[model samples]
Target: MLQLKVIQEVITLILFVVFSLVFFKNETLKWNPIIGMCFLVLAAYFIFKK
Candidate 1:
């Protein structure tokens, strides 16, 4: 189902972000990637908007 996929993707993204932040302290978070993630979640929202 669309809803299930969205939830899984969001959870995966959060886990990946947390893992990256905790393991890769040398690299600072950037706005572009953050915005890109936001767009991904937003796209999922639109898909479920119907």
Candidate 2:
């Protein structure tokens, strides 16, 4: 249950950023957000690692 929650949160955040970039033209992708997304991806990787 905990693992699922963590995975979902990470995926949701990543998807949110992606969708925002795709759907919102005024929203620009910055370095900070990109770095943050990299961290989120790392977190997701660790969560799924056995």
Highest TM-score against the true fold, candidate: 1
The local distance difference test score of model 2 is 0.84
Residues 1-50, model 1: lDDT tens digits: 97888888888988988999999999888998799799888978898897
TM-score of 1: 0.72
Query: What would the per-residue lDDT of candidate 2 be over residues 1-50, giving only the tens digit for each residue?
Result: 77888778788888898899889989898899889878877877887789
Mark the regions of model 2 whose C-alpha exceeds 4 Å error after superposition.
Answer: none
CA lDDT, candidate 1, residue 41 = 87
Q: Itemize residue pairs with steric clashes in candidate 2.
A: none
Model 2 sits at a Cα RMSD from the real structure of 1.5
Best by lDDT: 1
